[model samples]
Every structure is written in structure tokens, then in C-alpha cells.
Target: MQKILLFTLILFGIDSIFAVTHFLQYVYSGSSGIPNLPEFMTVGLVDGEPFTYYDSNIRREVPRQEWVTKAVDDDYWDRNTQVSMDTEPVFKNNREIAKQCFNQTGGIHTVQWMYGCEWEDETGATGALHQFGYDGSDFIALDFKTMTYVAPVMQAFPTKQKWDSDRARMDYLKSYFTQECIEWLKKYVSYGKSTLERTVHPEVSLLQKDPSSPVTCHATGFFPKGIVVTWQKDGVDIHSDVWVGETLPNGDGTFQIASKLTVKPQDWKTNSYSCVVQHKSLQDDIAVLLEEKNIKRTNQGGVSWGIIVGFVAAALALVAVVTGVVLWRRSRTGYGKAGTSDTDSENSSQQQPKA
Candidate 1:
């Protein structure tokens, strides 16, 4: 009876140990598929084995449910989906993306597409469309039907990374439109050939004098083709003579136009002058401040005279010292000879007296 009891106890201990080890391994391996696992897999397996084992069978039976539950609970999946949707239109060459983004965000006001001839010719399609809006903003091609937005990866205008604000970006766009785009448009687009023009404006600089002298000012800007240049004084047109400088072509196929206007000294301060440029796409003026060109004199007043006098005085003092030394030596010689003669005469007289 003792042997049988002891043997039964040993078997029970062995079975418990094996069961604990298996439970721990299962819990540690996350075979339960629960969102949160227990701290001690052995304890959880001992208590949760039936539940976890049953869940695994259920998951295998209803795979679709498992997928749906995972999708609903996973934050990472949602974020990735949003990003994928946002970038889909750009990569798919769909223009409707812009419209969707605009409508959804209520941020973009307008969209325009300016067509380029080169692109059209190469692709056998219409050129790219340049879009603009009332808010001083613009977008390119957007396909409303397909919900797609497509923009050139690289554009002539400064990109968002290069500018601090939308206003700065717009300003750069306007400048580029006047300087580079218009010329390119004219070359490629049939309609632009007749509408584009280039112009030049001149200014004046002042030279410093009793009051000051006036200098000529010149500036040049590229436009389409037939732009005009004018001078204005205090907002009034200056009727002064204007010289038109030669227009050179910018290597980029744009015109380099120049103008010169002669301004007088009296007109420098009394009137505010500006060089006005007028073009099909741009109407602006550059104000030139008449700056005084004063000559800088390194040697002013009698500052050098003091330096010359000091040098001459030092040389004269040196010569006087040498002359005094020579005179002293001659006097010493004369005194010595006289003293010797007197001594000899005294000795002779004394000897004669003694005789």
C-alpha cells in the first residue's frame, strides 16, 4: 500500500511539471492571439489554455472577421491608408486630385493650366496648362472626373521648400512669368508670339561736388517683345530726352533691353524719379535713388606740413651740435699752447734772478 501511494504521488508530480512547461511555452510564443499577453505565460496557460486554444480554432474558422477586426483596431494601417490616398493622384497622372484636395481642405481658390508647345509636340498632346486664381494662387491640371491631380515634379517657378510663404512664392511666380515664362511661351505658343514684349528703364546717380553732380542711370528687363520704357518724376512723366540702348538677347532666348536717361543735379533732390516698365504681362517701375558719389581725400588740410617741419628741425639741431664740438676743440688747443709759453717764461726769469 505504501509503495502504491508513493508511486502515484511521483506520477502526479511528473504530470504537473510537464503540464507547466508546455503551458509556459505556449504563452511565451503568443499562440493565444490575444492583444495583451500575461506576465507569466505558465500561469496564463494553466488558467487560459482552454480559452486560447478555442480562440485559435475560431480565428482559423473566420479569417475574414479576423482581418476586419485587425484593420479596425490597427492605427498604423489607418495612417498608411490616408497617406496612400493622398499621394495616389500625383502618381497616377490624375488631375482630379487637386480638385479633391481643394474641396476637402477648402484651401485652394483657383486652378489654371497653361499649355506648353514643346510638351504638346513631344507627346502629341496639348501643352501643359498654367492655372491661376483670384486668391493669387494657382494649380495645374486636375481631372475632376477621375479625382486626380497631376503636376510637373520640376517646375520653372521656385518650389515651396525655397520660399517661406505663399505670398513669396506668388511674387517669384510673377517675376518668372515676366522674365522667363513669357519668352518661352512666345517661342512655343502661337498666341504668345504677338503678345510678349521686353522693356528697359534708366536711372541717375549723383556725383559729390560743391553740391553734387548728376550721373546717368540705366537698367534693363526682359518682356515679351514690344514693351515700353518711360521716366517719371514725382509720378509725373519726365519729358526729358531719353536714349534707348540696344536690346540684346539673353542666352536663354530672352531679350536684354537697356535705356539711358540724363538727370540734372537740381533734379536729383527736388524730384523723385523712377524708370517705369510696361509689358503685356508686367507693369512695374524700379526707383533709382540718386546717390552722391563723393571723392574721398586721404590727404586733407596741412597735416603733412607739421611732419615736414619736424623732420627739418631735427636735421638742423644735429648740424648745430657738430659745429659746437669743433669750436670747443680749437679753443682747448689755443689755451694749452698759451699756458706752456707762460710756464717757460717764468722758469727763465726765476733762473736769471738767482744768478
Candidate 2:
């Protein structure tokens, strides 16, 4: 079974050259024997930004984005809430069925259903996916070509057979992916245009904890996630001795990354060194020289910049780490990438859509 690549849907900034691709996705998860978490949870995302959420504990479908709340009325929420309420039992039943199929008495287990659609405005191209997972692995998925369900594991074959035989369910899924899902995606995009379509360039900072430690080029507050941070030596890209961190989400829906270069103090002094940032938001790459004066010093006098920044950076890093761990754990138990389906069109069965 192919693992869902969580970062496959790449949302572009405003200055992008390529045409934008939008995504609408809903993930439903049900878990057993997990503590301090809702038994069933649902998340709806548009262009990778969560717009709505529902959990057993809340028992209500709530809008996560301000625009979502503004765009839809109380009736909309009420209707979706009912839908989610109905879905909760189905997810619970799925979990129980999955446990039995696996022959597990169960310590902790999860069942997940992820379904969504993607549309490319420029090309009139569309794609869709619907998949079910059992214990972090692919259980069954919809096959567009066969117009039937596929089982990845023997334990899931029964489900595939049953679902394939259910003509009503199959037709509903087909319509949901290609039609209903795309309509909803377009509506959400229209509602969140300003927030989703705009771009914010990164704030570049050269940070160094100490002279002996590697110098880090930090770029924060960029929108749309796609970015490149690299080290340059004497006007040339330097690949070795450089560690580029993963792009991480900021609290305000932007992104940040850090690229560290290991070099001797003498080496950088003798040869010109710089950190370069490339993004759709910028017309040209922004380069910050690796110079002592430009460095954001962490060695200030008594009770200074070092203490404050060190504390804040540490806190932010801790939060990112914890959040990543939680998401990773959830993905391991379910909540992974959408399963790839067989289809005629190249864009018809993507695992996840870029928005």
C-alpha cells in the first residue's frame, strides 16, 4: 500500500507562475482505547487550510476559519453538524468491524476514511480520491476505472466485496468526488480568496548562537509553504555542510524554515558567504550576507536579546516538535495520505491535490 504523502498538495503564493490547483478534503477518524482524545473526529480542509472540524466531544460541526463562519449561515452549520453526527456512528462501526477483521481484542486501534476532490481552474482538470485505512495501512480504496472497490489486505476483501455490490453507495461516492466535492471546493475558495490567494514574503534572519556553532539562516512568515533556503559561497550554491530544515507552519498560517551552514570562522571571512531565499512571493531571490555585523547576535550584555530570543525560539521549536509528533502518531494509526486510484485521465486520481 502506498503511504499518503502529507505534503503532496502544494499551495502556491500569489506570484506563482504556474496555474493554481485547489483542493477540498475531508478526513474522518475513529479510534478505540485512546485516552484524552475524542472517539471520532472529522476535519475538512480547503487548500490545506482546515475550514471546519467536528469531534465526538464537541458533537457539533464548527468552522475553523473565520471566512467559513462568515460565508455560511446557521442552517449550513446545523446541516453539516447533523451529517457529522450521523458519520460518527458509521466511523465507530467501521472501527469495530476493522478490529474483528484483524482478529484483535485491541489495545489501541484506529479506522480512518479520507475523501476529497481537486480542480485546476486553468486546465479544467479534476481529480478525486476516497480511501479507508485500518491501523495506519491501506484497507480499501475506490477504483475509478473498475467502478469498484479494491482491498489491499485480505482482511479488507470482505469490505471490498460488500461495497462493490452496493450500487447506491458506489454511485453516491462517484458523484460526491467529481461533482459535489468540487462545487463545495469552489465555494470555499471564493469565500477565502483574500486569505488564500495572497502572498507574504519571508522575513529573513541570520542567527548564530555562538561563533563555534553553525550559522543558521532563518526565514519566517512566508505564505503558501513552497520555499527554498540555500547556502552560497562566492556567488555559487554550496551544497555540503548545509542542513536545511523542513518547512513548518507558523501560528498565523504562514511558514518558516532554517538552513544551517557549518563553516569555520576563518573560512567565511576569507570567502564571501551568504544565505539565499527563493519563493513565489519574491521577484528575485533575497540574499543575506554571512557577515558578523548582519548576524542576529545571541551574545548580548546582561539580560539582553539572547535571553529573550533564545527563550522564544525554544518555545516555538518545542511547540512545533510536539505538534509534529502528535500528527505523526495519528498518521501511523490512520490519517495518512489518500490512496491512489486507477483512472483514465492523468489528473483524475491523484492522492492529494495541490491548492
Best by TM-score: 2
Error of 1 at 253 (Å): 1.7
Point out where model 2 deviates above 4 Å: 1-17, 32-35, 99-108, 134-136, 145-154, 205-217, 231-246, 258-274, 289-355
Worst 10 residues of 2 by lDDT: 340-349
The TM-score values for the models, in the order shown, are 0.23, 0.69
What TM-score does model 2 achieve against the real structure? 0.69
Alpha-carbon lDDT, every model: 0.27, 0.65
* Whole-structure CA lDDT of model 2: 0.65
Q: lDDT tens digits, residues 82-200, model 1? A: 43333222222222333343343333221111111111223222111122111122222222222223222223122222222334434544444334433433332332222221223
Q: Any residue pairs clashing in model 2, and if so which?
A: 4-337
TM-score of 1: 0.23
For 303-342, candidate 2 gives per-residue lDDT tens digits of: 2334334433442222212112223333332322333111
Q: What RMSD does model 1 have?
A: 48.9
